[model samples]
Target: MNQGDKWTYFLGCYPLYSHDADDNRMFRIITSQLIDAGLCRQIEILNTFGVSKSSVARSLRKYRADGIEAFFQPRKTRKGGRVLTEDVLTKAQTLLDQGFTSGNVADELHVKRDTLRKAINDGRLSTKALPPEYTTKSCRTTIDAEAAKNMGTACTRPEERIVAAFGVCDGAPVRFEPCIDIPKGGVLCALPVLLMNGLLNGAERFFGTLSGYYRTFHIIILVAFMALCRIKTVEQLRGHAPGEFGKLLGLDRIPEVRCLRSKLRELGSDADIIKQWSAYLSKYWMDQDPQAAGTLYVDGHVRVYHGGLTKLPRKFVSRQRLCLRGTNDFWVNDATGRPFFVVDKTVNPGMLAVLEQDIVPRLLKDVPNQAYDKDLIADPFLSRFVMVFDREGYSPQFFKKMWKEHRISCITYHKFPDDAWPEEWFKEQKVTMPSGEVVTMQLAEMGSFIGHKKSGLWVREVRKLTNSRHQTSLVSTAYDMEYQKLASCMFSRWCQENFFGYMMHHFAIDLLAEYGTEQLPAGEEVVNPAWRQLVRERSSLQNKHRYRKVKFAELTLSEPDANDENAYNVWFSLKSSLLEELEHYEHELEGVKERIKSTPKHIAWEELSEEDQFQRLSPGRKQLMDTIRMIAYRAETAMAGLMKGPTIDTPAARRILQDLFITEADILPDTNAKILTVRVHKASRPAVNRALSLLFKRLNNSEVIYPGTDMQIFYELGGEGHPQNAGKGVTQTSPK
Candidate 1:
């Protein structure tokens, strides 16, 4: 209601207060009180009364600070003045005379550049140009160098940290500039293969772009190069020239270790996203080579943790022959040992559990060219795909279940085999291995029942008799496959093992990517410490009981000659004592067994007592790094495949690739033509140089574009008598 220019406000028809419109101070005080009393909301006041939000906020802040009297307090006025005080001007003039720029002087004196320039223009200050030796250009950053080279002004293009500081640019596109003798320039040769293997596939979608100088693409390529160059850890980056390495990335320099780690932390904030990226890449790889996907090799590699931050569960590290605290990574690789994906388990449930629960489901979905439903029904022996692993996955029940439920086959070393077959049963047969090597082997096959007689499953058991007359037995549910192929496939499981060893030695696969630990999820189940202790106790008692029983039985108690009654009495006493101890241990073992049966084998993480609890190593960053390394390994493998010939075998080809990665080369960037020419220098050996030149030709044929750039990569050999110019009076071979 309004009366004589005064307005009254009401809530639910109850009068709140009345005041004239011109009485701004009273209005502010009452409005603040209404909001403070919860009679109205700030938004409601602004919306219903068409008042500015700042006005309402200011009124509330003033009232809250000084109560209602604050609205009537005197209004404050600004006290503005020239910031260039006499003392500040004196210091600025001195800095100007000492070769500092006007902008620098303004920054040093905390004054505006325009104000400083005005002072100079008024003749109040004088400036001097520094000698060429003292100029800032003498110390050029990567950004400044790129700018001088006409490669644009953005620092680490597509993502400029400098401009991004002011929120003007989101990312700077990747650009290249010409350079001479860039160290490790040969790493660019693998870029095509890395891209082919989907190194950056789904990266932007999953990780988004990092907000600073290093974009997702740069970090990934840098990491891949580091892996290829044998730079195992981020800390190793400090030992190398950042500017030199930055050339490989087409940047001024790779980010500092701390900057890289922050970028990694931001990219790996979510573990699920990393897994999704890995899965996407895995599908791409499988889809690219469906033949390799037909048979997958599954195995577990333990990454031991020596850190004292958290107490991880102990796993038997077969390589070290000792139980160690670590996590297990179950890798699914193709027959040739190229990785498809990996599943990490901090609380390992064993190979069988992982295959059935984590691995098989993924294989069933990802394994391409599964037999049609009608085709599967038409042929009883038909199977969708085969899984090969070590003996740890040998389970007759699992084999039967996979065949019956999923129509999937399994090949693994038999956990238990009968005595060797007759010598004449084995015949020498030539087998073609996955590596295209044919070898003669004494092989034989027979149908055998595994497990109990009544519930056992019939499987094809193939055995190979070595030159030493030792039989290597293998079990397979693939009934229709020939014994020769089964033998080759089973033996090829070593490819995966070799993959692990090579990665551990060269790629540092077992190293911890990060040292952070996180608490395990509440419902995550781990082995129960109490149950494990009870089992250990029972085992100790059983061993003691067995020893005592042996002692008691060995006491023959032969009747001593009638003349040696003392000897007979001593023997009887010892035998009686042994029997008594055996009986005691037997009783104790029974009690312990009963307790073990009563205790739960696995308990949730939250159920454990404080002292028994532990956090698991952070998997997010490790998983990301592992994926990049996997890509790097695959790329190297692909290049090695191209380099293999009569002179260069797989091992030699890989060695050449490693050397090529660290070899110096000249980089010629043709911006107009959009081509990046990496001229690799010749190797010490003429044979290796010829092989590298051939490899480069093959890579150029693919015409793979550099990631994050439009430039097509062109690789060639440098130095005299290069293979490309061999016809021009240049010998292909160089003498020592």
Candidate 2:
């Protein structure tokens, strides 16, 4: 059809019937062509020649249902057409049957070229036996009768039958299948088994406490493991053989490559989900068991880099990192050897605020109010009553402030000149090491430092020790306490260092890689500059200046908003209400009549200023503000406790948890209780919930606790003996 005619015809279809008269005319012509064909006749015949009113209606219904193209279109023909003369037909059939060319038949017939072509073009002829190139080649193989007979016999040969059974159509001989079986007790599976056992009952019962986001986090880690240890390329993930990975995960079906790629791309862009998942997992690790009141270790570390790459926007940094920088910070539970919260940032004032105002509050919320009884361990960077500072964090004023605030009971070690202490307190004293070695010492004790001049409770302890390697002075908050036995606290510090190592060596490696490089071709840079220059001169000077000013304004003040309107507002409102209640209580005064009447005009004016006059003042305003502030602070602290960024915690802690909890089921014995294993290609809230549901259904169990390595033992031992075996203290298998 011509373009206009086609358009007209197209418009005549449903939803476009309102088009001009030209479209209706095209539709009529198309319908007329359908009527001319036998399709209309067949419809009329089926409806008894449309004589009966019902029959006419049926015929019309059939006509409309079939559409114009279906009624008028000819039947589709096969490759070759009809044969003309018997001889030409015979020749074509013989060649095709014997695997010869159609062109060969045309040449052998020695007739006008169009004669064979016409026969082939007709519907009577078939070219099913011809190869794809038969129409182009003139050469034909003459069949040998004896050879054809032999070939027919060869098709039935036992070897050929065996080849067919194996699905090998080619003529090559088949090789025997290998019978070797590898033992399953190798190191490859041990690590995951061990991790699973630890996760179930040892300390962190991760499975039982897993949240939606935490589940997603685990899935992401699983994907990372797969990428690192199983399949390496995106293409491989897409086109992977189902049998191979299916056997590994015990899956009935394998995910497509597109699904995995889509998941990875989604996770890369979704920082919010990552943050939520990180927090959820941290909480899960911390609250694994109620009996275990875990000690959380907080510290900071640096992620150094060359200055070529642009940094991520400040808002993208985790809330934990926004408070603390320079030194990486993490919250580790010493009881479980699990690092839950971590953050990394450059050294800056904003980062420090995040640590004190954000991270600490959240962590403390997870910790019961009574948890203050247990000292929070940190380097000198974190100033607490019981502060531990290395050479870099040494500050006398910091200790004094902590003492005044009654925030902590601390132990810090220092070294300085003898004159730093008072002469009377420097009298002979002795300290003993765990190895039974004794050293005479003089301690320089301090009553008060600069900031705590009035309180006078701050004290410094100093000692002099002589050794073959070096003779020097030692200082500490743990005055005359023995030195060597404090190794447990020292070892705790080592765990923090290990966490730092993991962040740098594992998680940060990939993140830094993604940010540091330009993925586009070098030529694109040259083209980009030209395009920018071309657009630069198009606008008016005033407009350009205004745009520049606006852009600069955005960049300079682009930090995360103090009160983000779009954040979880329900929680915010709840906090605001609580503050309002607290303010109401604070403003309540007994016998207010006298104070109100006797108050001076200036004092009354000051009271009015203190009131929120900009907004309509409420009677309970003071109590309300107090309550809301307290609630908001508590909630913020709770959330902060759960949040852990990739920068703070090392991959080692995650690795240890994974090793203690996750394991393969192939080597274990089967049981009536279904063993559910889900391989989520994508890690996210939805994926995690779906996986949990599937696992729950498959196991026929109500609750599926995570990091539950004990499940492996139950799975292995089977039946009533399973729970008993756990009671007997079974050793955990290491994860592969």
Candidate 3:
């Protein structure tokens, strides 16, 4: 055959059935030659002709059971028995004894390693015995049992007490100290510890001296309030301790609220007192534990509302608007969120400069005896740890002064550009950023910026899209390697947001809302000390007045009524009205269902007579169909428990229904709008129908109705300035 024909003959045809007789004859000749060469047997040749080599071996075993004639005769098939040779067993035992390599032995014996190894494993061969002294039993039940019993005895109560009283000293003596006092217990001890360490000084001074006036309840409430408001003010103090003038002053009777307000006013402007308290609390906190390190987070927030109308010279304007800013510079335990030595101050160039200068010195002085390992963290506005301005905050003059001060250790984020990164650093790494985009970058190939005086600031430049089309590059000095993996900075920014969130949400002292108002004069404008003093004095007085006006009893005590006849009568009337309204709604719902079921069914156009099919639908028929569908849907919904009738009489249900359905038109001016709106809607058929559907859905679902009143709901639904559809929108006037 030709090459193509040969190719088809080999691959496409069966050796025994192909028309290519020469190819089939060649195959038989090759098989017979292989059998004659002892590569295979005669039975193998027959079996190969019949099936395969493996089958040939199996057929030979069957032939031995029923003679050579069995090849032609049919016999029941049985599993072949193992053909274990003496050589295999001998090799297995030899390998197990000498730790002979399994692969090497299998190659030498011309057998599978697993098969030989399994023979040894199956206990067909014995591993040579080792010396008695060296061979240890794998399992020793007696020793284990003895050890468990001893452990049980050691764990007994008497043994525990002895162990507690006398601690083991090495493998010899025992040391005992049974009378050691437990560390001071509870908040009482904690407060003193905090005070000694200077953690409570700022709070103590701001809230007044804790020596004779601090009551446990007052302190607890005050702390709770401070935690809530974030910033302590005279106004908040009065609000939380209303009516109990004595409680405010730690006395038994009600003191004049004015007196309490006066005291806070006196204490309010005393920055020195707060400073002293902050120092004391810081000291107290530092002394309590030797192993704990103190790290303080210092940050500033601008209370923009406070400086609203404040007049200032052009020089005093730092980046624009009037502002009463406060530095929430505080010390906190690194391991815990406990705050201490807080100082809230008005921000000005001089004040800011002084506060910045004093923070480190005060912290160091407070923790004088302890090792000074603490670190300070803040934004670029704060000076570096070594007292140098951060490169981001650097100016030529600032750096010159910082160099003179020799506090370069504090300059953590600064670096020079001449330094070449290592080749390994150039390995590419991928990061998924806050915007859910994958960014590929190499650590070694990052860029740097030059700050005020050629000071190098290492920053990563990232390209971000602004307003969709505008791509802008941002440089960031604060690098969070782990945040790169997340889809958003939300989780990473949580701690930072929480600090502000606490001040806004919990403390009610949203700096943005409460401060920097026009009412407070700006710093430079009040450069004249006497005028500034007058402004401060007046501000304090105004604050005290505001504080008094906010006073309302935080807790009230009421006597129980001896006669509840009026209450009982009111409740009975309410219950009766609710039942009557519920019954009426049920009856109306049944009528709607009956009306829907009585409607005529539609006839198919093709099945109808040609004249009837061509006729246009009458307005009356269309209305009937619409009415039928609406009623049927309402009935089915009601039966499915997806809608419910409103209960009457009960103010809550009436409130809900009226809020859900009635519109502004249904609300009459000067009337009891809550009740009158409901009455007006009841008189309007369309309003009533709409109300039944809307209120039933709302009430059945127990959903909260926002703006919870008919007038509000109507106005929200585009009722304002539009009268064409005001009272006739999407609602039927006639009930079924």
Candidate 4:
């Protein structure tokens, strides 16, 4: 059959127009099977398939005799006088100029490669021009050999001066004696926890003294304390008096914003060391309290990029409901909503991919061993690492892999269920929140299983029905966990979201850590924008073709059949035109398909030329900020746990903590008794004053001395009347 006659066979489930040569050849194979199986009777096939009985018979006989090669294939027929369309020729030239090979251009324009070559040879089209974006150029960065050689071990301070300042430690360990001499302002409240947690504890002047008044420890402390005080950015220091904030670090004056950032760069240069320190603190936390890993919440927080230095791929910021240029940071927090750790996802990988590839593997190695104690958790099932996340980790295959391969159990929302649980399955239960509030809610579990295999070895899926006829499904491998408890763990993924929200609102978590682009590694894989555009164009054309085909069919089916004569010719004329247009779109779609087949989904960053090659952002400052913010939050959270009930209202505790951090208190140092007393004067609110009194007693009970002075910490309310210090008059008090 000719190409025109063969299109009449574009009927049945496998439409001929919708497939390529390979697929049509498979279609013929399938047809042979059906005819042999007695499912394809010639009369019925002809009636439904629009193909004549004679052609159908011929195709079946030829297919059986020749074993699948006898089916009619589309042939490349040259129209004797048909000239290339202006649009197609223009497109072909444009692609050729963009460095596309002649064969590629020919395929894109639906012309024979030989035809394109002849056109180029005859000077009808030029394949010599090159688009600027695709042209490669050498990037030269100057290197001062002497300076580059000496850069690593260059110490600004003389060795003699360091030995003089910090007495020469000839095998004597350099240690920071717990100084009860902590400033009693906003910093005193959390310094003990911060110090004990070992955030800036191990940081020392290993390479010798820096130029700033603050040592490395002091610089790190200043950064953390700034975040604790809700001074989210360095620029915010402009609003604060330096002397006032400096007192928090026991310094006469705080370092300038530039100096602090410089120190951060100096200290943060050893990223591996800092990360090890951070990991030490996390492991220590879990070691002290294994319940912290009772259920770990994992999710991604997209920090939108507002700068224009380099364009990041657009990520959907769920908060704003708008996709914007940003970086994705996957955070893993414990059941208490305190962050375990956060990973900066530089390449914009999806939440699930990052979880399995980076987050989970790390957790499996670091946690589980240190997080669970034999005596702490009575439920053997609870001892298994239970990771809670949202629907991003919802693949049944992933869940199965997590359980079988790594022995890591997870809780996440189930996304692919068709029907909601019946109303009778749901019942109200009083669930205790992490904040200790008893909440009454309707929750249900059918113990429904998931997995393609039907041996019933699958995750238990639970659902929570709402008044609006909505159902929220949670699937977990924690089969031994109580249904209510499982439901709670899954729903608590919001705590991580809340953590992101809180950090963004109060700590400027969304702020750019630093606006600097770094050199991307050569040949790093990146999405091919040109290939993506081609896919988009192909999809658009396919959609248009489908739409026009439907329109053509509708016109032909609805045509007036007033008689089988000249009266209905107008509608017939319209149908015939639409069909011709539909055929043109189909042909163009085939050309697009051919083009898409050869384009790679991702190309090396170096392939895009120098300007596009260096788009990856630096993570140094962001990592610094994330570390400090987590420590500050952890300390704040610990203090909040103590002030839960009558001492401080649980709900308003975060605000109260902020107030305490910003409050002006009198620093009373009783070095004679080895006790430092902080006399907090009258607060703006009496409740705050009362709450601080209780918190002070609680901190004193811990007997945590300050970092450098030998005195037990003490907190006292003003003896009688006191004036508002306005962040002044908070000098360290001496012992009588």
Ranking by TM-score: 1, 4, 2, 3
Estimate candidate 1's alpha-carbon lDDT, on a 0 to 1 scale: 0.83
The list of candidate 1 runs beyond 4 A from truth reads: 1-161, 557-559, 720-736
Off by over 4 Å in 3: 1-256, 266-269, 286-298, 306-347, 350-497, 508-736
Model 2 score (lDDT): 0.35
In order, candidate lDDTs are: 0.83, 0.35, 0.33, 0.66
| Root-mean-square deviation per candidate | 26.0, 30.0, 39.6, 39.9
Residue 603 alpha-carbon offset, candidate 2, angstroms = 38
**Candidate 2 runs further than 4 Å off:** 1-218, 224-246, 252-261, 265-270, 288-296, 305-337, 350-355, 369-389, 411-457, 460-487, 502-736
lDDT of 4 by residue, 1-736 (tens): 1254243233456543333334556545555656766765767666755667676666677777876555655544443325556676788787766445687677766788888787777666787643333211111011112223542111222343345346553211112222212333756778777765656544552323455345655666777788888888887877775544544554434656786778777766666666766676677667666766657888888888888888777878888999888878888888768887888765665777888887877776667454345533564454367888887777777777776665678788887775866788788887776656667768877656666674334667778777786888888887667877887777666788788888888878888767687756575677788787888888898888888888887886787877856757877787788888888988888887888788887887778756554476777767767787888888888888777776556547877888777766655443345555555555677777777677777776666655544455565565422112211111122111
Output the TM-score of candidate 2: 0.36
lDDT of 3 by residue, 1-736 (tens): 2343341222234432223334643444444444444655666556434656665455445545665455556534322215347756676566556533455456666777677666556656554553343211122223233434654211222343344346431111111111111111011111111122222224433444322222222433333223322223434444432212221111222213454344333343343443454445445545654322232333333333334233322222222454433322222222122333443333333323433465555654554343222322332322222221212333334434443342222222233333434444444557554223456644332554546535544444333222343322333333432323211221222233344434344334432312222222222122333333445554654555444333311111222243887765665565556455555545554554455445333323344333322221112211211122222222222222322334332233333332332121111111122111111122234443454445333332322111111221122111111111223211111111
Score candidate 3 by lDDT: 0.33
Model 1 per-residue lDDT tens digits across residues 1-736: 5576897988888887989978877888889999999988999888777889999999999888999877767755323336776777789877876545787678777888888887777767888843443212224355545654553432334336567656676544565666667778889888888888888778888998788566788888889999999999999988876766787777766777888888888888899999999999998898999999998999999999999999999999999999999999999998888999999989999999999999899888887788999999999999999899999998888899999999999999988889988989899999999888899999998998898776579999999999899999999999778889999999989999899999999999899888899998768999999999998998888888888887777886454565788988988889889888988998898899889899999999999999999999998889899999999999999999998887778998999999999998877666666667787888998899889878888887776666666667778777321122211111111111
Q: Which residue ranges in model 4 land beyond 4 Å of their true spot?
A: 1-184, 205-212, 368-383, 449-457, 521-524, 553-558, 561-570, 594-597, 646-648, 720-736
* Model 3: lDDT of residue 549: 33
Better of 1 and 2 by lDDT: 1
Kindly report which residue pairs in candidate 1 clash with one another.
157-172, 158-171, 158-172, 158-173, 159-172
TM-score computed on alpha carbons, candidate 3:
0.29
Lowest summed lDDT window (length 10), candidate 3: 178-187
